[model samples]
Target: MTTATETLLPGTDIVLEQLPKVSLHDHLDGGLRPQTIIDLAAGIGLELPASTAEELGAWFAEKSNSGSLVEYLKTFDITTAVMQTAEGLRRVAHEFVLDLAADGVIWGEIRWAPEQHQQKGLSLDEAVEAVQAGLDDGVAEARADGRTIRVGQLISAMRHADRGLEIAELAVRHRHAGVVGFDIAGAEAGFPAGRMRDAFDHLAQSFFPATVHAGEADGLDSIRGALLDGRALRLGHGVRLAEDIEISTENGTSYARLGELAEWIKDRRICLETSPSSNLQTGAIAQWGDEMVDHPLDLFYQLGFLVTVNTDNRLMSGTTLSRELALVSDAFGYDLDDVLTLQLNAASAAFLSVDDRETLTDAIIAGFEPFLDAEDAR
Candidate 1:
């Protein structure tokens, strides 16, 4: 049962929170409950900008809304600070899954850089293990509550750091455990994925899947490196790829011409893990406009790009997958079919095996059937 606070699909009585959703770009550290942060901070002797949960949540939201990716990223210092110990990582990971489940996410990939959580002597492997344990606990708890949710770790390496190869190996070593894929994130403008060629090469040789953070803080060149060097299966916040598209108005009709880069991404069906609220907060969509309507997500969808909506940082953005979908629906006038298409796109792009992907796709279709039937009846 969804609460009054649950987001409803625009122009429909259906609760968006009850829809089957898939999250591909959510951050474990960025999804913690504000009270959990306070509790963990007290244990670790860390000072936070706000004391109460409400204030802390608002502080994160305000700090993240600075409209600069750099400024938006500064809020992570507070989040990652409290996530040093195994206990802290576990609790945060556990709660992260529960939150995703509560938001009606049936499958989610929680991405985070393990190297950043070693301030308290936890090894990289230990950090991954701790998070996996927490995810497992959360899954069990969710199942007990009759919520079916599955989660995987997308272990990330900081782009500004030189530990890409090391992190890649760690991710591969734990593939059979809870880790699903690998990624390179953080400060995308200067540090291109080419810098992590060795890591990508290793992942490719090992036949592991990867998604590179590109086209968010950078442009086409960065996205090119992600595909060419990193061999990314998906592009994280690939919103800027829209820059390669030229829209011109001739007569009363407007047409879009795709550049070679945009053409290739579109032709190949590479997934775009777009975070609507976080994209706005980070100024990722400022080139088009500052409003949700200005988001190229609708343009991308109209052009048949494999786009999936996500909540990059729920705490900072004060959003959920359901909320992200509802925002896009409201902005683009997307109905139930559009929403289902987005979920299907995400299900297909998930780092699961072909059979697993089919299973997920079936589950998503099944979940949306009743709603679609109800819409038809109406």
Candidate 2:
């Protein structure tokens, strides 16, 4: 929590934390509470890198900040180790929603690979059921606490594995239960979306939504594969799609020439789930620069691309949706309107139906109206 003295958004009194937000790219295994990790690891007889919850949290931040993707991903090894059982999965899922609600997330979609959680003899369906149960409990608990929120599962398939079809089926099977969409996570470099074409084809045929992790660890071709083969409705951390645009300046004026791919993305309004802190930690924006200011997010947004803010891995990046919004606003000199635009972008890109999206849009607008009105009076 930030003190009242700390300005979250520069030149404004609006606290980003109080604003209604949507989290489209947060991961389940990557957002565990450190104390929960310690307790779960203890019951499972797993070793931890840090003894105390505070120390463990710091360990994750330190490793993620090491500027190595391998080191950043290694933190997940500790979290996943403790999440092999039904109880572990349910508890984590429950807490994940509570944390989001505290951060003012009205809606969040948590993506995680089910194939990675079957170590303790739980089938994939069982794993999904346990997570859904926890999410349902979380929603009920939040309602009881007077905080309204909804969360859905984006059952992710590991790209390096061959269970894409299986995971896709699992997601569709649970669509009426709690599952809202399908995603392909894990390594994106060598394992392109084409490898999961059958699963994607099945999803397309079933009219299920999909989001693909591309343009983060890999480059343009990976993004191309995600769109063409995976039929992804959204691109997770599609920051590298900026590579396709050519920028030039004349007399202090700039012009951007978009390639056919970039043009299609912008014109069609394909959402780019950009997570600033996590993108920097994973070197996803290294080509642009080392700082948040160098992220292509500002350019993408300015060029009319559908850009949505996200917290890709909350624990690893030590961020919330509010923090990510604040960081981007600070880096790009954005105001409340900019922040709201990003939030609306997320709401529009959510895997819910058009009517549900409109309902969410209305909720977000209603939530922010009071604050915006207050700011106006001041």
Candidate 3:
């Protein structure tokens, strides 16, 4: 490991790296260590922007912060290039979990498109097995290190491609292995969830959980597809759903009106996995404004939508779940209790059984007790 001036953490005094958190939207390819990328690139005869890991890391941060999602995504070409082989896939997944554990993630759902990793001629089953092996090793390592961390694969299909149905079947087939859910990612605007109806249908028949990427690059129609056609249980970066909510004040009183889609999401308690900084960088919330305060997260949270803060991509976004929470708290004036509430929301929305969800919720509640008490005393 490179010696750095400071550790990435929430706070210096409180052992921020030890705080309990759950990550739902983290991506396996997006969280790879820059060193790994550099070495893997060298091994694969791939050229990189920088030779040193820190410089390469800086390059990614600079390039990603360009306020263009397309530019931000270009960085992933380097990562996915190296993840095609079994060793690369397994090591990347293993390291991804270890990094999450270091960032204090108690649980995470790592989503990556398997279709993108078939460059090395690995079959779908082979790719899944590689990632599963990595996840298993990571979990064992976490346990041995005195931290019980869990990770599940949210098998993702590319919306811009025609392999959704096949990927959905792949996820269902590997449900007992390490896969936990299904999702459609990549090219959100023109490629609505309806484009992958067959995949969603297959997943629905299998009773699998889906979380669609909507309301980020596209507007309400995309979200509608995710809900109606995709039957998504959760929304990935559904921050733009706030567009349907009308805000007004009359005679010093404030009220809000929710459109049909927003009403359904709220009434149904559908989880909105909001990533603050990443959204701003990717222009997902550009229509709202450039500032975090302009984000509708506070509005949705107050409106009773299941709002769970997440780090969409740790390396790409250069953020952790704790940092996301800290950023949200800074932008939305959330206290420790509010942080706990977000964790509780995530635990409830996890794609686990009712009993497991309840158990997870209780664990979250127990872990957050000190924060709750600290906030109460203040």
Candidate 4:
């Protein structure tokens, strides 16, 4: 990104990337390294929009920042083009984890739709296996490097397609193999979770967790469908759920009146995977404003909703989890305590056993302590 990700903060001396973090909504396909894309494209004889790695990175950033979901999704064509083979998928998954470790992420969930990579005619299960193999390699490599990190797969089903049931079954079939949960992605406007009732029903019967991408291209109705119909434990970029909240001033104090949908989501402690830069780029919060401050992250947190910040598309949005947290912290004038709260929310929502979640929470609390000490000394 020509804008330079280092400019994410103005005067903060501490590099937040080194702080322990948890990533809930990262995508394996959306985060391929620019060099990997170029090399893979060459191997597959696919002509890229930009021949060089630097140029290709710029192309993705520009297209994603265009504020049109269709145009933004076009950038993925280049990434997925080179990721159809087993070798390609494995390498991408391995590197995706390494990048997260370098960014100081202790835990993460990498979501990708296996249905999209079938252009090479690989079966749905094989694709998931390939990615899992890569994730194992990534974990071993990180431990070897003395940087401990863990990641799991969240197999996604394309909402516009009819294979959600199959994909959901694949996720459940591999729950012990590597798959952590199920998600429905792509074109959220016309395709509501209600349309995938059969898939959700089957997943519910299997007792598998689901996260739905709602309130992104659509509004509160879609969010309602995700929670009610899909039984989502987490909302993917559910920023537009803010549409159901009414903020008014009473005696110079702000009070909120939440719609039934928002109230249910908040009362249930449903986690909102809010990605600031991506939300702005995808026009998820366009009705609010053109900047990151316009994001509903602070509002959701203040209203007691389980809000977790994320880097939805690291390559496209040119952001990391730390960058997203810093963006919101600046917008809301938050302290280190606020940052820890966000990470705690993510740790709790992670598709892990209770023991694992407690371990992760402990890690985050320990990691944030030194930063708090630094602030105190100053």
Which one is best on TM-score?
A: 1
- Candidate 3: clashing pairs of residues: none
What would the TM-score be for candidate 1 when compared with the true structure? 0.99
List candidate 1 segments past 4 Å from native.
1-4
RMSD of 4: 2.1
TM-score of 4: 0.96
Tens digits of lDDT, candidate 4, 172-209 = 99999989999999888899998889999999999999
Residue 258 miss distance in model 3 (angstroms):
0.5
Model 3 lDDT tens row, 92-163:
999988888887788789999899999989999999999999999999998899886888999999988999
Query: TM-score, each model?
Result: 0.99, 0.97, 0.95, 0.96
Which lDDT values do the candidates have, in the order given?
A: 0.94, 0.91, 0.86, 0.90
- Error in Å for residue 88 of model 4: 0.5
**Candidate 1 residue 207 C-alpha distance from true site, Å:** 0.4
In lDDT terms, which candidate is top? Answer: 1
Q: Which tens-of-lDDT digit does each residue in 304-344 have in candidate 1?
A: 99999999999999988888998999999999999999999
Q: How many clashes in each structure?
A: 0, 0, 0, 0
Name the lDDT value of residue 54 in candidate 2: 90
lDDT of 2 by residue, 50-161 (tens): 9999999999999899666656887789899988999999999999999998888999999999899989999999999999989988989988999989999999999989
Q: Single out the weakest 10-residue window by summed lDDT for candidate 1.
A: 1-10
